[model samples]
Target: MKLSELGEIGFLKKIEASLPLSDKSVLLGIGDDAAAVRVSRGKTLLSTTDLLTEGIHFDLKYISFYQLGAKALLVNISDIAAMGGIPRYALIVIAVPDNIKVAELNELYRGIKKTASSYKVSIIGGDTSGSKNSLTINITLLGEAKQGNIVSRGGARPGDKIFVTGTLGDSSAGLELLKKGKRSGYLIQRHLLPAPRVKEGVFLSKNRLAASMIDVSDGLATDLNHICEQSKVGAIIYEDKIPLSKELKKAKLKKSPLNYALSGGEDYELLFTVKASYIKKVYNAISKGRLSATMIGEITEMKKGMLIVDGKGQKMPLLPTGFNHFR
Candidate 1:
């Protein structure tokens, strides 16, 4: 049952038999040297890739192969969502270790395939290789959007309001619980399977509701700094405005949940900016329960610098403390 016994070619043949081509956009799928895809006229292509390595990005002891596979593809889907695109195709390359069983790899592929299909994505092609000790999954996702419907991190301007979808810090809180040997908690599930806000991002972009947007993968502070750095603008956010989940709020921890909201990574929520004139429309949607988001701050002039106003109205510099692979 080991992958070594089946070998790469045999394993690939098994995978090919399991996946049927359903999307017309994918001219070719698995078993091809490279995938051939079709792009609609007047549409822009959005491509994003992510790499997850065992021990560095995840610990297999705490996660199943199925969960790991789903998370790997979902994170890449989040990137396409941030760009306001509809996911269409994927290239999944994995490095398998000798200790892994063929059944485990099948479960992993099932996870990726299920998540991909849910988002209307086709698994086009990928390469498999042998690894000494670690399992690595690298996914390249391809998406499409109308030329004018794409959002970027650099479109934010001064005086624009900052907003984020859903609650924050739940994933990090879930991670904390996992470290303590706790399982089956709500917080733990949030950490394991974070959802991408593709509908929200697309709606905002198509409606021109958001001036700029980015997913909160590297924590709010760091990802917001990405927008700031890209747009060459400064911002001021209120501490009390940062949204927190009830589950995260109830969890007892060494540090405040607010701290996790600020710098804890992998929330996969969308953080965006809306111009002042469009603020009313956004609030209207929020009031109608059509949109789930909170206005946290406003963009400021670059010279003003990034700052956070405390509950007492005290101002201080906002720093990026999110997860950095090298740091």
Candidate 2:
């Protein structure tokens, strides 16, 4: 059935069916203005907000409202994770049109609650208002880290090694698949539900392995450029060293996956740097059986700018080409 026919409540019921609540601190889930939680001492608070609009951030034709709600919260949690913090609470504000049904609103909240519970975060409070045409969701996540343990985007030193959590370009590849009307399983899932590396981020921060970190909500090239700009350093990413999903490889063989991986946005993985001394320690903390951390790059002097070495060993200038609000 078309989304318009489902109204809003009908859509919400569908989403509510899929949620599994495991957290005990969530006094109210999917039915309240906010979520509540308890926290311990010696922790500094971390907060971040992400705003998503109907046409600007997503297309209703391809994305489901349930997924939209989950993604909205997930992206903000990713920002908190980028700072090496544990998400504890969220405040969600939604602006909806008159055509929206009460059920659809419930479904969206279901998505938010499900994601928040998974991260063990509570939804605290927010505001709901009427809008003209677009459905807008603004999520503010509250997280915590030990005192002075928060990682930032500006701490990468000259000799630090650049590392990334999880594979890159999958989201972009997934978007390409949707645009092409292809139904590849991997790409579709990647696009619909990109997991934020919160556990890994907390581990890195607790162990004091990461010098600085940022999530690749934007493309790697653009996000890494952000690190460079903030840290006053340059970086060198090895082209062949970039990790690609099998789905991405297939897409590349058929088209240009590198361009999408490098310039496309919404990867949700953490891009972090560690001092040369902590490289092994950080790797040891994040390494799983197969998904090992690869040394894809290094921080360089500010005068060098960002560079990418092609497989043929040629140095090429790196341009910051990713999602921009005003571009």
Candidate 3:
């Protein structure tokens, strides 16, 4: 069957099922956004890559070249964040359409360099090529974590508390507003220049806080489902507990803001779990980033099932509407 017909998640499942078992050096592979491996004594290596094609992942008419470049790097950085690793180097491959000006390309490079500098990562090497159609960017990022500090999606336990960094749905709202050509600065900037929660990730790892973790790249519902599936657990999220920005709350909309908060993508925040004993510390540790972590739910045994409670105290199954990638 064709990929379009199969859909992104279905296509990915087929690819994953067909792949061979990872080598011994590979600590984690295929299923997660990033892969990790044993690199050296007392240090494990983390690597992730992503691709962005013009007219697909982004549209040139609305976004600046600089923001595109920064976002390209930031997406990869977010994968590293999911693993609680310190990013060290990057390799970027670019396919440029000849019609694009050299000066504009330079501005793109400037943005990439500036973001790398802020993260203390170096652009080590990559390939450049000419594209016959449009611009394409592929980036491979490398990071490291202390051998004992690494966390994965498979570590959550029943009764663990679920927490997330910053607000949700802002980026999704930002994109919708951007498409309408509305002028909300924070929303537009979020859709354009979303920040990775690197420091927050590091704090969680170093302090031994999060039992399992993943970034909110694909939205809270989808990403949290990743953790639950890998860990063989269930969850219950409270509708009123989800952190929605004032912009999203006040905006005139067709759907509930809670729907966007649950299903919206591109927030770039961290969704993590912690044992009940350490839940208080999770809240205390997040102040380093000037944002508070919100506890939305608790992990439960798989048979208990995944659910969300609404404002009227009604309970229902929490089905994820996050994967618009296929629909």
Best by TM-score: 3
Q: Which runs in model 1 stand beyond 4 Å of their true positions? A: 1-41
* Residue-wise C-alpha lDDT for candidate 1, range 141-226, written one tens digit per residue: 88887777778888899999999999888898889899999987888998898899999988898898999888998899988987
Model 1, TM vs. native: 0.87
Model 2: pairs clashing at backbone N, Cα or C within 3 Å: 8-103, 8-104, 9-103, 9-104, 12-107, 34-123, 34-124, 34-125, 35-123, 35-124
TM-score of each prediction: 0.87, 0.84, 0.94
The models' CA-based lDDT, in order, is 0.86, 0.79, 0.86
Estimate, for each residue in 1-327, the C-alpha lDDT of model 3 and write its tens digit: 766688777777789889977588888887775788888887899999989899778888778889889999999998898898989999999999999999889989988999999899899999999999999999999999987888899899999999998889888777778788775577678888989989888888988898999988877888888888889999998989998888788877666678777888888898999999997676665555443689999999999778898889998998756854555
User: Model 1 clash tally?
Assistant: 0
Residue 72 shift from truth in candidate 2, angstroms: 0.6
Off by over 4 Å in 3: 286-291, 324-326
**lDDT for each residue of candidate 2 in 1-327, tens digit (9 for 90 to 100):** 777777544565578668856876332233211222324455465667788999888987778778889999989888878878888888999999999888887888888889988889898899999999999999988877775677778889898999887788888778777877865578778877889888888788888888888888779998898788778999998999888887787764345777877887798888989998987776665565422456789999999999999999999999988876633
